[model samples]
Target: MWENLDRPPLDGRALTRALVDGPRGSWSRVDVVARTGSTNADLLAVADTAADRTALIADVQDAGRGRHSRSFTAPARSQVIVSALVKLPGVPPGSVGWLPLLTGVAVVDVLRTVAEVDAVLKWPNDVLVRGDESSGYAGGKVAGILVEVASTHPVVTAVSGVGINVSLTEAELPVPTATSLQLAGAAVIDRGTVVRAFLRAMGSALDEWRESGWDTAPIAELYRSRCDTLGRRVRVTMPGDTELVGVATDIDEHGRVVIVPESGDTSPVAVSAGDVTHLRALDA
Candidate 1:
């Protein structure tokens, strides 16, 4: 798989040491694999694993997936793909709504500060950035996050799967709406740096979430501030192929998107799951 001998694979030992050595070290372990079907599936079934903060990094994700089980595949060694497992023993099931949103915040923060790119969250968990102006692309989806939850008798755990486009060039983009860190003029494309920064940010965000008992107000407010979907004319293609065009007004307390139709007096409709597109972005 890794053809580039010069590019180091994710250094699990170094990552674990860095994650566990600091005073704020919240991670219990880091594991790296040469290839895997899906880290989220692997972590969900890791019964022998201890209950703590654990991350699994892979060189090749042959069967990665996104929110709707959409295939998410990138060439080996071209991106930072990782899944972080977090166990929260006492958190109520309702609080789980905050997991994906908080994880998005973490990814956005790392992209902006460490990678020196203006990253924004697209509603649930897609990360978007503006590419170079010369490329004729204003903004493209650069990363994605998926959150899954597994429960044991005594505890509940969440797996946050993240994919960050690191060193891919324009020609290597998986889709026309997607771009990579290198193409976006990121200051660094070190996969290890990106992973470490993401873990640190996730740890901090999880702490804030737990402290607030998964309060939706503060988290929702923060997510709204960084979210690029709000105030945009959007199209939501629902599960049954039904479509609705409206302005994305807000995110309800249930983490559902509020869509106010463009030409109708219909009351706001909150959708739980759908494929969203920025109509204005497409026209731009």
Candidate 2:
């Protein structure tokens, strides 16, 4: 699904080639583009015609997107941008919404294994490393995941994109709280190794998801176990001018954040989409 342009292509070919040669349980076709506006956009452009297990990767995205349409920034040749296309079988239509969460679990698995760092999930789909005294929660955002789904007839193509900060220094971090493997004291990690580990992890997670449907309990537990947001005072901004301030309780079976509101309401509210802000801690 790549249209080779006249310009020199980006160097994602090495990674694409490696995955093609690596162990893939269900993945069949892998495509690597040098530069794209967004890997998600590229996958969507050809989603209707592409086969299952087709992976689209780019070296850098000029207009990468994250949850809530936030722009994802990756320096040229310093990060990993990979999107895998999968065809779901026998999964209910409504349950497809949790694919991103499942993919997040896989991302965490790969990061912990490949980088050998303590990576945590920050709700929804952000991977965070704990910050030390000097860094102070500038804990690196080692990786992030985004999934897009399209259905036609008997097959649903889920385009899963994962971005990892492999070699960026502290100065290269996109945000104050962001971090990279190098800055997190990880030795020089090979991007290709990280890519393969992630693909294998994703393949395993997808297999489990297809077999069990969207039972998000295991996925939620895995996420919560590595989550840094749990048990913290935070604000969740919902759509259309609604918000909730509460103690982050737990993630429910359907991948929703269970929150205990400030009004002392014991009933749990499931938050499907929102911006979360962790309250600052006061010194003792």
Top-lDDT structure, candidate number:
1
Candidate 2: lDDT of 226?
Answer: 73
Q: Which stretches of candidate 2 lie over 4 Å from their true place?
A: 1-18, 21-25, 134-137, 264-266, 281-284
What tens-digit string does per-residue lDDT give for candidate 2 at 131-250? 778655457567787877766457767787788887777777788777788778764367667776787778778777666664656766677787777898778888986878888888
Once fitted onto the true fold, the runs of candidate 1 whose alpha carbons sit more than 4 angstroms away are: 47-49, 131-137, 281-284
Q: What tens digits encode model 1's per-residue C-alpha lDDT throughout 69-155?
A: 899787787889899889876777777877898889889989999999989989878999955578665669989999988764477
Estimate every model's Cα lDDT from 0 to 1: 0.85, 0.74
Error of 1 at 244 (Å): 1.2
RMSD of 2: 4.5
